[model samples]
Target: MTPLGTAVTAGTERAWIEFRRGFTNATDLGFYVVMSVVVFAILWFNRDTVVQVPGYELPSATYALPSFVGGLIAFLSVLGVAYALAMEREDGTLLRAKSLPHGMTGYVVGQVLRTTLETIAGLTLALVPAMLFIDGILVDGVGGLVWLPAILVLGLLATLPIGVVIGAVVRSVRQVNTWGSLPLFALIWASGIFVPTIALPQWARVVGQLFPVYWLGLGTRAVLLPDEAAALEIGGSWRPGWTVAVLVAWAVAGVLVAVPILKRMAARESGSAIAERRERALQRTY
Candidate 1:
């Protein structure tokens, strides 16, 4: 078999092993399940609140749930991958992988696949519950059954590799908070995920629109919200085409950026590098 093919096969096996391992560990599974709970609780708290948009109104919980889902997916994908890579890098995991032929590729592929599965499982916990209990969700009904999964797959494609790239670029796990999580948090806040874009400042709106998160939230809202909820958006429309265009662009660019950087990152890994990383991490802790 070709080297790449062998790596992929190995990676798939690794992902399955990790995913199943997660299922057996209650603490880990419980921790992952908390996101869904927190999100659902947020929605439940505002379940009855109504918001007045230009020509329409919606229950805030109903309105926010979809955006929250999209934001959470991006948040989890980026931070999760970033932190894992950073921690593994510090602890000699990447160094070990570097000793194997094509192991970096397998490692990257495994991380991506495993995280995607985890994200899907985590979100399903929130979505299925919210669908059952929250009013005005699944607004498109049967059609939503189609659109929701399609949007999720696209959003994952768009965001996961961004995570990979971020993971590759950061020097250490500690830096991930500063370089990856904080920036992502700021980006989501600027985007319309937590609040309506119409209410954000003009520059914030412009900045939010520049990234994939905004489009992801927009796309999810398009499905989970009523058609008129589009009025609450920046242009007073859903712009489904724009959502697809932006996400696809990000997916392509993220892969291009992540691959070479990840290769460079793996190339630099060594026992000495990991020891230096740990020493620095220890100094920071002390």
Candidate 2:
């Protein structure tokens, strides 16, 4: 097999291994499950209040639930990438991977695949409860179902590169655990997950518009809400087409930034540098 083919095979294997690892990690599973339940329960309980908007019809409880769930999944996937990279760096696994042929490419592919799987799994888990509680989750019918997943995938793709950058920069697992949650919290809040963007200051709305979270929520709202609902102003009127374009731009930008940063990280991880760093860390702790 060609070198690229070998790398692809290795990446696939690594993805499977990581998926199993995630399953075995009871703490992570419990965290995700509990969060999903809480978010959905809150939405279910507040369905009447949410639907009480003056003119537009509110989204079904099922629809709102999935959007929040999907957003959480995306956030957690990014966190997973950061945690994986940080732990590998601390454990010398990253250093070992760098010694293999096409290692950097394989590692990047593995991270992407693993994150994608986790995101999909999380979304699925979130959807089940929504479907059970609310009728007609898709406001746009079959079209919404088809387009929603595509848009969400794009949104996740847009965020993955940023996750890669974070993984590359963080020095250790402890930092990853501590710092990772902050960004996730900020993005969810700013993206209008819990509150509409219109309620925020003008500048905050503008800043929120620049991130993938906003576009994700926008696309999701488009799928779940009626056309008249889309006309509802949030951060200066929601535009589904514009949201898709912006998300694509973000994904492109993420790819542009991630490639070089990942290369730099791979170069730095080579030889004995990571090992030496880990050794120093151990010594310092002892």
The segments of candidate 2 whose C-alpha lies over 4 angstroms from its true place after superposition are: 56-63, 177-179, 235-237, 270-272, 279-286
- Least accurate stretch of 10 residues (summed lDDT) in model 1? 132-141
Per-residue lDDT tens digits of candidate 2, residues 77-193? Answer: 678788888778767777777788887778888888988888887777666666676754555778877888888788888888878878888777677656776867776777766
Best by TM-score: 1
The 10-residue segment with the lowest total lDDT in model 2: 228-237
Question: Global lDDT of each model?
Answer: 0.85, 0.74
User: Which residue pairs collide in model 2, if any?
Assistant: none
Query: Over 4 Å off in model 1, which ranges?
Result: 139-144, 284-286
TM-score of each: 0.93, 0.88
What is the TM-score (0 to 1) of candidate 1?
Answer: 0.93
